[model samples]
Target: MKILLMLRDEFYQANPGLIEDAKKLGDVRILYTDQGIAKDELIKEVKDVDVILVAVVKIDQEVIDAAPKLKYILKHGAGYDNIDVEYAASKGIPVTNAPGVNAQSAADHAFGLMLAAARNIPQKDKEIKSGHWELSMGTEVYKKTLGIIGFGAIAKAVAKRATGFDMETLVYTNHRDLAEAEKLNVTFVDKEEIFKSSDYLVIATSLTAENRYLVNQETLSLMKPTAYIVNVSRGQLINEMDLMGALEEKWIKGAALDVFEVEPPINHLPGMREVVATPHIGGATFESIKRIGDLSIANIVKLMNGEELEHVVNGVHSRVTQR
Candidate 1:
């Protein structure tokens, strides 16, 4: 069995031991690349692979067709939107992702970004480093209204944290669990109310075709000028151009981003002190990676050994064994 793992250089650096463990399962080929890797290069490398473990590089029908020996395609993290799981299923290739393993890690980072944006933490630190001493007025998070876009694991984890700050959590999601909302002390509200009432708004909903660019000029217009928006979810959810205009016009207080639509963003909007950006490191903690690594490798081993597959996103697991 041949297992091909593709992620950035830093991820490999953090999990040298995990790579070694994967070698114990089969012939492991690791690629150091980001999400925007060329399709030709990916096709060339995947020609004879039995398994493909990818982080960001998309696995469309072309790449799937190129891998004649392909049996399994595993996402190193959540958000299998990068892969065409339905197409892979049609081809009898099983696709799975390590989902919800980094909920706490991502939730922690979301809260951190919220506080950083609200308090202008990065801006103040920069000023102090440049030999300036002055106080900047920051928003008080204590007892503020926190609005979340989804009710998934990460969102739930975030709502749990909000309790400690005595925040009123408002959620907007198509999949409403009233019992869970009552238990967490979060209210299920509409999108307009979420935008209008939140002191901090977090985008945690899973990215789908329907909800892409969920945050636009109309939504931004509804937000209070003092409210801050933090996205710990996929970047495409927010219209970057619209967000840029809002920031320039002070439509909202500020924005903090963990992901960008075209990462690493071409513009970055470095001149805008109101914008704080991170390289999608919400789930990059060492602890979270270990959980993803263990689950990913274990799934791969199961596939190779003809054992029961876990975390199957595509319904081709049974067909894969037949092939």
Candidate 2:
């Protein structure tokens, strides 16, 4: 048996123990590249491997088809959107991710962005560093309405922290699980209502085809002119062009995003000073990375030993057997 670990150099540098753990299961092969393994690269690297571990790399149908002996795929992070789920299911390969691994860190980053945007912290710091003392008036989070776009673990953490600021919380989820909503004291409302009523609208939803451009012109138009938007979720959820238009037109006061439609290209937007942006570092903390690495390795090890995985994305299949 063999396991191929595909990850960036940073991850490998942080968690050298994963390589030793993989050696216990099989001959371990490491691909320390973040550009993503192309189909041919995946084929060559995983040809004789029994398992594959990946992080932030696209695992499409072609890659799955190339590795005939591959049984399981372990994603280092919570989101498994980069993997082709239906195709992996068809191939009888189970995919698993480290859910809630970075929830706290991501929530903290979300709140940090909100605070920075609300108080103009970034602008003030920049001005001071450039030899000026401009004390601009900023809004307060207390006694304000906070609209959360998703009710997942990260959103729950955010809601918990929001209570400290005495902010009213409202949530919008597709399923609207009332029992869960009650626990957080968060009212379940329609998406439109959340958009219209929120002073600080936080986007924490997972990325899916149906809600890809959910925050386009119509939704932005409904928001208050003084409203601020913060997105720590997938960047594709908001249409970049529409967001740019909204900021330019002052449809909303501003936006603070840790993720963008085109990552690293976030700075390319004209007049981006109207918004605050980070380089998708919502889950980049050292603690979060360690948690994710440990969980991902554990999941893969369990699957290799014919044990149940902690966060299986696909239903149980008998295709993978321990040798």
lDDT tens string, model 1, 1-323?
78899975678877777799888877899888864678788899999998888888889999999999888898988888889999999888889888899899999999999999888899888899999999889988999999999999899999999999999999999999888898899999999999999999999988999999999999999999998999999999999999999988998999989998887788755347898788889988888888888998888777766787888988876333432
User: How close is every model to the real structure, measured as TM-score?
Assistant: 0.96, 0.92
In the range 1-323, model 2's lDDT, one tens digit per residue, is: 78888875687777777777677767788887655455676678877887888876678887888889888888877778889977888888888888788899999999999999989898899999999997699989997999999988899999989989988999999867677677777898998899999999999989999999999999999999999999999888998899889998999999998877764463455237768888677887778888887786677667756777888887755344675
lDDT of each: 0.88, 0.84
RMSD of 2: 2.2
Worst 10 residues of 1 by lDDT: 314-323
Candidate 2 C-alpha error for residue 10, in Å: 2.9
Each candidate structure's count of clashing pairs: 0, 0
What TM value does model 2 have?
0.92
Candidate 1 residue runs with Cα over 4 Å from true position: 318-323
